[model samples]
Target: MAATRACLVALVVALTFLFMEGRVTAEPTSAGSLVQRRREMGSLLRRLNKPPIASIQSPDGDVIDCVHISKQPAFDHPLLKNHTIQMRPSYNPRGMHHDSNITTHAITQIWHQNGTCPENTIPIRRTKEEDLLRASSIRRFGKKMPRSIPHLNPTNDTDTPNILRGHQHAVASAQYDKCYGTKSTFNLWKPWIARGNDFSLTQFWITGGSYNGNNLNTIEAGWQVYPNLYSDSNTRLFIYWTRDAYQSTGCYNLLCSGFIQTSNQITIGGSISPMSTYGGTQYDIDILVWKDQAGGNWWLQVGGDYVGYWPSSIFSYLADSASTIMWGGEVFSPDAGQTSTHMGSGHFPNEGFGKASHIKNIQVVDSSNCLNPTSDVGFITEQNNCYNVQSDTYGDWGTYIYYGGPGNNHNCP
Candidate 1:
């Protein structure tokens, strides 16, 4: 009985050991199997839920949006290809929010058809009144007119007669002897004068014709001080011409006629026809000086208006001693066939005949000082009396009056 009992006890101990070993091994295997099943199920679910690779089209070109997954089960799947993903119409968060009601394909089509993404669309606003005003101002005055004339060759003493004399006949429509005088008073005959030893009366000339055998028409002549003459330290020159009136209509009408050549050969601004003229009032032409800051250079502006400007080089020519400056008769060439005929009909009109151009003021100012003060006053003021002068009989005034101003004076009406 004792041996049997001992054997039973041993068997029971073996069974217990076996059962413990089975439990230990089976626990790990079962757990591992469950984990593997879970992983497979997750992958299948991801595949079922995964969006298809989509091709996107834009007006600019084509692009692709694709999904990708890692082969390693340890890594999570990614919706887009690594580093290969591109911007597409559907991916824009803002566009998605704004266009929630619209179809994704429609939104994509809009972007593609537009050539750019819809999020980038922006509406251009209209210009405001202030902007319009600013633009108008720019259009009116910002742009500058280009220079019309170029520098001319230097003039010598001999060339003076040919230029001045020929211009006298052509300009005056007649021929007359050149003379010099100091009388401040106006004269119809011998209308030129040479001041001091350095300046000659040949510097001035006069030309005109008889209108209806009544009004004696005349234009003054002068040599443009060559560009070289302005350099002479000893040369301090003053030139003057006069217009007198028998009546208000008789004085030389500056608006109707006047011209001046610059030392550089460029013609300063003058009127081919009356821009402004008061028959009895005297108008004076003078040279104004200017300097450019860039090169520290000087320029002479003729006729007060910006129409004519001469560089220091041209000023030097005018100041040179080798050239004889002529004024009055056409300082250029004579108009072909008009010279003798103009001289023959020398009728001085009692009402509109010989009148003098008066010099009321003289001033020297920088280029900035030469600005047109009434630039914003509009066309009426510009076309009229912006120069503080009145209109002429012909009702036309050149741009000079607006530029050449007695600023606030309305002397010529």
Candidate 2:
């Protein structure tokens, strides 16, 4: 405990000295030096050591899990530091990642305004329509529209096309190992150099026996070509959820009543486009999503960028915690007879890196709110012919899974 505390202090001191100039360095000195590395490590250890506090049910029949944490987010890249320092227009948890500029007024003022939350409790920052129209072009048209950007990879004649058999998934063991947490992490590969109108993505989800069971919360990211989805056909990070099963409300991303986008770091469909290379260069995207057990909000992050969150007011069972957490590849082919686009990397999970696509370094927030490794992994797919999934843990690759497929093929035939 002493060592962890010292490390946390060292990390903060070092960063404070570097960015103290107020100029965000090209690449943080923290990532370049061994001392900086250890400092970062110390911060991570400190956070993991702290146990999670108990949660409660709000008067609105929602679960409020905003536990108190004295320590601020110690592991964020310098880029996220300044961004998180602002006063979120919505619900703000006690310890939700903030930088050195953090102050008592950051969230207290907003929390104080809400008479709903109990003493010491921070209510979920429910998103208003004004909040919804803030970050998106959807506000311009007054509603959600589709984009024409396609997720198809730019390919060479010599490039090999994926001939997947069926849809596949290499999901972490959430139920089998009885795993539970507020957040999860994985290294996701942006599947490139592929074809098809289908879709491929990796995300976090919690579900009961049925979608309408006790709870079902899904947060997804990847590439897709859907007419019913965005205003375009390009691949993009998409989110979907259902509190009372699909029987009633709950829609994708900010469609209905749930998620709120606070950052312009990612332009929804722009910024990072899908690649079309195979062995030449592979771009793996990092995904991190955690339910602010304290604030009752689901957070989404990619790489060093903190995108936004899904507030607790959007759920019932998920208002507190989830029963199952799934992270893997899934493809959507609207027509059963039409399987085309790709999921994850265009290659199968067995392809490893530089070739096939895969997800690595999987971790989940335990009941204590600390990130922990799962006990095992499980694979599943509707049809083994059109797409498939597999996993490996070798070298820098942590717990990873690869899955994709080519639709209407003999393998699935």
Candidate 3:
């Protein structure tokens, strides 16, 4: 019996020793760690689920889908909404009515500290009417037009109409936005309108630049969510730029010479139908436009591909450290009497679901050269009568937004 007991004890000890060894082996090592495993899985998934090269048409009605560029996420890194926009009194007075009429020379002088902008802040430029008119007169179509097409984004404020719903902004703060980049996501809205008149659609402002007492030009870049701007009913991508506050010098992508497009793949004013694609998360335009650290050029990445850039020379304020960045929507009302033309999906931001438009995944590149989530939020707009914005927490998606509304419905006419 004693001999049997001794043999049993030895077997138990041996089994315990094997279990300990197995655990140590299971532990991650320097090279083959959990991070490595996740990266490998991500790469495989991207390859398997890679979207085919898009066949896009140019604004001039040309079949221009020549290159296959992969989709990129909205930002270089995951965007966290840690910081909020720090709006100055002059920028958004009486609550959140940002200077919608900022283009007027009347708003040219900086209201904050006489344009000296306290230390660490950049000067703000308010474009004059004359400059905007000059820029609007010039037209630079990317490809030769088969025939004459009406000019887009009229430089003359009088020429542009506001058939779409008016806009109220929920801007970001520059005090903490010392970040390198800023990005947002939104569902592509399809604005419906009458056949003869140009439908007023949606446009957002990504305003930034250095401001001087003179030469009030701020580099303005953002996607104008316009559909029928080319006179077609299809929902097309319309890009816009204002190197010197919508002056004739800088036009949309590849339209004018100053903005150099490096990639031929991305079709400016490309069509994005069925805006929302289904899989796990809803569909959206995940775009990240940032200034190159060294060159001071503005580069825009739609989805995943490095489409192209706006050279630094085009922007006096953007070429250096930009003092401000505005993210919000706008629509041109061609006629005050006309109200059928809608801005977003023709629904209020509170309408939620498939009806509204939004700019989500809001993030900015910080002074650290990292994309840190911003904090201390401020929200509002000049014309709450037009539309409104609501910030919400979207599970793992972080804080997304619900914005937009129908036109001509609310005592607008």
Candidate 4:
């Protein structure tokens, strides 16, 4: 019996040794995989960080590089190799209302503290190695996940209504037969992000085609707080486009070779200073995107400056006209239980002007190239308990909507 007990103990010890040895043997393979990933990341960085005419160090810890307009990343695309840069739009939309009540505070990037880019050059936010590492993978470094755009009509079968995967929104939308453009003024704020990957934004979506068809062409521009993308919580101006529902075409800002930027004063993906506070002086930026009837290129105007254009040759649907336009706040959280990321001012629309975030002076361009105030607007909120939207048309504001909320409050959770 003693000999049998001793044999049992010995067997147990031998099994433990084998398990420990297996774990030890796995470390080198895991280390080798990490080494391979780093090597690939380094190669990608070299291709992205182009030779700059000059570089400026931003107060927000960003490095803005001024590259020659002709040598910008947009030319890297095979489609844009022979593309001639359109200095300005061929036709500017008319019938813009001159609202005297609009303040001219003028939103500018924090990088301007040092200096502005020289003429015939465009400012670009420099990409860093850490920025690539923060992403899920090198392939998706500057690209949003598939199906990131909000679905207009989500089914009621799920617990969360009107949500597209992990994305939530409180937006106002307008649909038309052949809409040429849309414009809005968005109140800026630095909302709280629950996690590193979660993001909050307010932008205009000029969309054509359908997500079901896999040809959802869209152009989005506005301000966002995406720590994972920028590696900081600073409110930065951003632009994004996807010709095929974000599957394999297009990316944010100039990360990929799509949008050709023209403005020397504004840097795409640069931080915007003087964010709006609760019940304080509000800061805002004007975003206008209109298709030039003559050139067929879609032009984007930020504040009073004509930033640049998305060539007509790159898009299949948006090249003609947009069928629908949306404006307002959207938040993204990868957590299954929902993140605590705040949207807009982190207050409900009922909080009103000084306290709530707003997008006012909404307008849509008709086929005749005349911009008109939209009256037929529909507001949709994915989860009312989490976030909501309220709109009103009065005074010079003109069809304004105050939208947003704290993400994981008592009512929301």
- lDDT string for model 2 (1-413, tens) is 78866855765564554344321233334423535555444443443222324343423222323322221221122322333322132332222322233121110111222233223322222222222112222222112112111111124222222223223343443553233332333333444323232345666565433332323443444434432222233444555656654544454543343445545333232213434356755444555666665555677665555656656555666666665666666654334334555555556556665666555556666555556555366655555566676766544444556656554466754
Off by over 4 Å in 4: 1-29, 153-164
Candidate 4, overall lDDT?
A: 0.84
Give the per-residue lDDT of model 1 (tens digit) for 1-413: 78755744553454344345331122222434434533543444343222323323422221312222221111122211232211111111110101133221100122223222122111111112222122112221111111100111223112333322322221101122321110011111111111110111112222122212222222222222111112111211222222221111211111111111122211111111111133432223333333333332233333422221111221221221111111121111122112221110121122232232211111122223231111111111111121212112111111111111211123322
Off by over 4 Å in 2: 1-173, 176-198, 212-215, 221-223, 231-233, 269-271, 274-276
In terms of TM-score, the best-performing candidate is: 4
TM-score of each: 0.20, 0.54, 0.56, 0.90
Q: After superposition, how far is residue 198 of candidate 2 from its true place, in Å?
A: 4.2
lDDT of each residue in 37-97, candidate 3, tens digit only: 3354345334322233333233334343232222221111122122121111111001111
The total number of steric clashes, by the backbone 3 Å criterion, in model 1 comes to 62
lDDT of candidates 1 onward, in order: 0.21, 0.43, 0.42, 0.84
Q: Going through the candidates in order, what is the number of backbone clashes in each?
A: 62, 37, 36, 0
- Least accurate 10 contiguous residues by lDDT in model 3: 89-98
Q: Which ten residues in a row are the worst by lDDT in model 1? A: 89-98
| Candidate with best lDDT | 4
Q: After superposition, how far is residue 11 of candidate 4 from its true place, in Å?
A: 40
